[model samples]
Target: MTVYALETSGLTKQFAGFTAVSDVGLRVRRHTIHGLIGPNGAGKSTCFNLLTKFLAPTRGTILYEGADISRAGPAEVARMGLARSFQISAVFPHLTALENVRAALQRRRGESFDFWRSDRILKRYDADARALMAEVGLTGWEETLAGEMPYGRKRALELATTLALAPKMLLLDEPLAGLGQEDVGRIAALIKRAAEGRTVLMVEHNLNVVASLCDVITVLTRGKILAEGDYAAVSANPAVQQAYLGEMAEPAHV
Candidate 1:
């Protein structure tokens, strides 16, 4: 078995004549949380789209669990146990928290979304859906409409839905993007709990969370890797320092 759950090599993406991501290689170890961080316009989102197959790479390959998935479509890769969450919370606005998660469970079973199915049939997924909700700290909010829930809770619900897929690797885009300070710790904790027995690749701007949570951090700048290492090593790199010079002198632990 390979040590990496996800790997990419010589990955490049070009828009018209401009390069968005160039010669990037990323390897995410099995069962570890890897952080991807960089300045705005650093190609983090583009790289993520390539990995998830939302956009085909102009060059190079993507491997998931040692299988080449470079040419696979998003749904195909998703069925292969690779799932991703968007920066924006994606949940059925009218669906209750439990229902949203149940829907995902049904999808994972290769069943068409049968929201109108008889309760007797849909009830089978209820227990598992509630458990997943509880896993993300949404136990008491089961009956609330996803859109009515607080932003942080909605993010958690999105996570529960992603977990319903039972992915081997998870790609989280800015999981903490819109969260307030208080909610940051809560969501970050949920992410930590979710990482158990799974590999996570996250693109985030909050360096403190990355400092605490990531086993390895890959820094990108101007469409290429600027530095990569544990928080201490990557934060100390002169190149990384210069890259974030005006924005942040250095990433500080809080």
Candidate 2:
């Protein structure tokens, strides 16, 4: 049996009178790309937050490498190698791409963000910062301010920063949310490369992208698991097809 990198049993979240996620169990294997997808209100985001420890679950046990982390805090989970990216860009707009990546590298090295540090202390991180920027295909734009970069590049920079953490499991919430058709492919390729030795669990709306990148997919609908399988199996599911009607175009079907 393959030991999963992450797992959830009876995962659930309740907000007042409504249940956002109910009795959800997920088994994300090691070093594979897995996707969570559904319609607008399918509790994808809620489940994501639960796994990332952004929100405490009302009831559930989250296991990471066989350890229960349901009670772990966000920072704890991050330090434990579970990192997440938000839907909105998470870069510092004023910082140059190199500077932004250098800062993240510095943080990972246990350096405080104290601005009083000398140039020598900061320069120590430059080489690695440059390599990370290049890893995300931001090599030539190193000196540009993050805000000045185009939207796609900005998203890449955000991903570069996330990579600085060197997480074992990465959670991306709508990684391709806002981009042109062109940028979508670029980011998708980047994601595939980033998943080389890490487990990635993503919540994405673009079914085509999901189809191409995901080794396995779990579909949620109305806060429940509608289907789970490879892209072809899930896409062929009658219930999944019915649930997606009107929510997404028919061409998105696999």
Q: Which candidate leads the pack in TM-score? A: 1
lDDT of 1 by residue, 1-254 (tens): 99999999999999999999999999999999999999988999999999989999999999999999999999999999999999999999998999999999999999999999899999999999989988999899999999999999999999999999999889999999999898999999999999999999999999899999999999999899999999989888888888988444666766
How does candidate 1 fare on TM-score? 0.98
Name the 10 consecutive residues with the lowest summed lDDT in model 2. Answer: 245-254
Q: Model 1 off-target regions past 4 Å?
A: 246-248
Summarize candidate 2's per-residue lDDT along 36-82 as a digit string, tens digits. 99988999999999999989999989999888999999988888888
TM-score of 2: 0.96
Residue-pair clash count for candidate 1: 0
Question: Against the unseen true structure, what C-alpha lDDT does each candidate score?
Answer: 0.93, 0.90
Residue 16, candidate 2: C-alpha displacement in angstroms: 0.7
Candidate 2, after superposition: displacement of residue 237 in Å?
0.1
RMSD of each: 0.9, 1.7
Error of 1 at 177 (Å): 0.6
Model 1, position 136, has a per-residue lDDT of: 92
